[model samples]
Target chain A: MEIIKTSNLKKSYMLGNVEVKALNGVDTSIEQGEFVAIMGPSGCGKSTFLNLTGMLDTPTSGEIYLEGKDVTNMNSNMRAEYRLKYMGFVFQFFNLFNELTVMENVMFPMMLNKRSNYKERAKELLNLVGLGDRLNHLPSELSGGQQQRVTIARSLANDPKILLADEPTGNLDTASSIEIIELFRKLNQEQGQTIVMVTHSPEIGGMTDRIIHFRDGTIEH
Target chain B: MSSVFFYARKDAKKNWKMFVFVIMAIAISTANIIIINGFMDGLTDGFLEKTMDTSSGHINIYPNEQDKYIEGLGIKEKKLDGLDGVVAYSPRITAGGTLHYKEKFKTIKILALDPSKENEVTILLSKIDSGKTLAANDRDGILISYRLADDLKVKIGDEATIVFENGKIRVFKIRGILHTGLAMDTNTIIINFEDASEQLNLFNKASIILVKLQDGTLSGQYKNKISGELGIQKIKEWEQEIESVLSSFKTFRDISNFMNAIGLFTGAVSVGIVLYINILHRRRQIGILKAIGMKDSQVLFVYILQAVFLGIIGILIGDALGYAGTKYLEAHPFPDPTLGSLGPRFHLSLIYDASLVTMLIIILAAAIPALMASRTNIIKAIWGE
Candidate 1:
């Protein structure tokens, strides 16, 4: 089943007087339970495409369908609701709220959705991420890889349909990167979670079910 | 909703030290508004009370509009004695006279009242700076104002001669020095009502009757009663007679208001700048929250709730501080040369007004930054773009 689809997506911005096209005329789809990697060199539209698919940024001109429902023209409020309900995001920097404890950070998405049993759910997610002992520690008190694990635990808080990651392990060392990818592979193979990850590393891309390589502003043929 | 409150509470708790500066700023300004207003009220009320105590006693009954003196005083006095709410009343025979000492003399307004009755009507005898009030049998004894005595260079024992307006001359010993804080203190003389009546050949006549009411607030009611009973058309309440004096107090209030307004403005600006900087520092965090599904209104609400929390806590502390300061002033009044010992009175209405206004100002101050924070573009704020 097609969990995500986009057609002729375009995005542009202006720096000084010149226009910079970030994404140009991309057509793509991801099946449910598919572990896909968007691979590219620096400055490619892979990250932009993921952002567009996640509803973080609107395309200059495009249509996006999530689980066969058109979401391209949704307003910010509706997009926020969709983001909370249908998607989770992991960024390069493991953007955990520094002020929140590890447990509170995981509980944030559940709280946003007003889900019941959020505290227990957060503890369960934290233990699954293997950071059960670090629940009360602040993000700054944790290590780089541990913070990324917290972010991953938080992303799973609402049990999103699609986990969108933009270089989820880009800041980690090789050993931590391998551990993070192993966790992603476990979530994908065991739970049949759909994931669309953006990264530049070919090794990580090769580990996924399929890789969509990109160059300038669109996918390479 | 709960998200807004949770975030607001957590943010304040996590960075309470940063918010302390903002709260203290609000508190100090609130305290100043209360203290300044209290001081101004005290000064104005004290001066006005002194003026009223030395002159009018809540209500004053002047002579009939057509007569120089309210003739037939015996009947008027009897009616005044039976009037309800009348604590005391004094009849004064006002006469223009010229005082003469050895070397100098000045024209003065003479208020001749029975000293015993005058004491009850006003704080007259108690204001004597030195010497003693006249005994009922102490003939030829009169009290002179301290300013008048200074001008004439006369002591309490010295004798002063006065030429009555009716061409009668009498020499009286200065029995007491009056220190009443009014213009009357400069050139007024207090003589026995009998002596002035005899000298002017106006027996059973008085220019005005001053009536002291049990409650000062009942002046208008008592004035109407006195007018209706006595058929005196020239009666006035102290408020009606002191328009000019009250204008001076209005000026004091206006100045106090202007000063405190500036103080509040500064406080508001401080709150604004601090919140703005705080928003800027947390821009990335705000963006992350938005990216994670926090709506724009929730973001706005979080900051606004923070402001409300700050306002409530700050205003509470400020009210306590201002209340303490006012009570301290009341307990230990500071002295003023013109108004005697001055103390600020604590009125709940004043504190309520100050707290409510301060809360409004602080909330508005925080809104600008909160709006900016809420509407920030997610990608740009997160990326520092």
Candidate 2:
């Protein structure tokens, strides 16, 4: 089943008096439980497409349907609600709160939802990411790959349906990048966790079930 | 709401340096207000007490409008003995005189009182700083104000000749020197009533009468009563007699009160700057919160609660420091020439007023910046675009 769909999506921005068209008339869909990679060179609108689908930014025009529900016109608060319950996000910087311990950071999103068994769930997610021993440490104490794993654990705290990642391993060393990709591959294959990722490396794209290549603002065949 | 408090506590606990800076600012501001206000109150109160002790007798009676002296004082004294709430009463003749000592001439107010009756009515008789009180039989002795003696370079054992209003000159021994810290201290003299009657030849007469009441607050009531009963037209309460002087004290007191406003402003600014810098440092954290489905109002409430916590803690510490400062002054009073020693006084209402206003101002101060933080662009902040 198609879990995410966008039709003729377009986004624009004005720098000075000139309008920059980041995305123009793009149509795409990702199936449920599919590990899809969006690959392109810089400034090809790959990040913009991810942002539009992840509810990080609203499109200037066109419709986005998540599980057959049109979400293109959702207000900011409704968008946040959808993000919290149905979608999760991972960024290149692994934006874990530096002040919180690894366990606390994982428990944070669950805390916002006022979940009763959040503590136990957070610990389970951390153990799944293989960072149970590092729960009490801060993010700064961890290596790049370890911190990314914690971010992954935190993203799963609310049991989101689709995980959206932007350059997940872009900041990691070669060994760390491979380990992170393997973690995603494991989550997708074993747990059937649907994910949409934007990456610059062809090697990371090769591991995914399918790769959607883009040039300028449109998908390239 | 629970999450708001949860995050607020995190700020106080994790970012303690900012909290400390804001709290100290509030403490110092509160301390300054308390000290200045307490000092002003003390000066006013001290001067009031001195006036009642050395000058006004809580109620003063003058002659009828048509007469120079109240006729039949013997009858009035008998009626006063039966009056309710009358502690004591003394009839005095305030006369003008000129003094001669070592060829330096100065005009002075000669206040004549019955030695035994005066002793019952006022403390000036016993407040002799350097010598003894007037004796019942010592007819040729006088009491000079200590400040007057200072001006004239005279001592208790010396003699000064006074020319009375009737032009009768007499050389009297200075039996005592009085320091009551009033205008009387520098320009007045006290003489026996009988001597003044003999010198002035005003037999059975007085210029005014000073009446001591059980409570000074009832002076106006008794003044009306005295006016009706004794038919004295010009009777005045102690409050009326000291109106001009007390206004001066209040003017000074009012000026000092301006500091309370400045103190509160300083508190507002301190908390404002702290929250401003704090919001700047935590922009990404705030953006992350917003991006993760936290409502804008929830985000604003989180910072507001942090500011309120700071206000409450700062108010507590400030009250303690201010109270301690005032109490220390009470223990060691500042000396003055007019009112002897003055001590600062603390009012519990000051804490209530300061806390209410300080809390309100700090909340407002914090809201401006916290609102800015809550409204930050999530994508820009998180991605640093």
Question: Per-residue CA lDDT of candidate 2, range B1-385, in tens?
Answer: 6656767787668888868989988888777777777888777777777777766787899998899887788888887888999989888888899888988867889988887777667776877888888886778988998778888888888989999987999999999988787778878889888888789887778888889988879987898898888878899888888787789877787787677778888898988888888888888788778766677777888888888998888888888888999989989988866667878877887667667777888899899988987788888878776
In order, candidate lDDTs are 0.88, 0.86
In candidate 1, what are the lDDT values of residues B131-246, reduced to their tens digit?
A: 98876667699889888999999998899999999889999999999888777887999889999999999899999888888998988788788999998889989898777788
Q: Residue B278 of candidate 2: its Cα lDDT?
A: 85
Chain B TM-score of predicted candidate 2 relative to the true chain B: 0.88
Candidate 1 C-alpha lDDT tens digits along A1-221: 99999888899988899989988888888999999999888888888899899998999998999999999999999999988888999999888888889999999889999998999999999999899999999999988899999999999999999999999889999988888898899999998999999988889988899998877888888
**In model 1, which runs have C-alpha deviations exceeding 4 angstroms?**
B63-72, B95-97, B136-139, B163-169, B198-205, B214-218, B238-244
Query: Model 1 chain B: which ten-residue window has the lowest total lDDT?
Result: B334-343
Model 1 misses residue B82 by how many Å? 4.3
Query: Which numbered prediction scores highest in TM-score against the true structure?
Result: 1
Residue pairs clashing, model 2: none
- TM-score (0 to 1) for chain A, all models? 0.98, 0.98
- Evaluate fnat for each of the predicted models and list the values in order: 0.53, 0.40
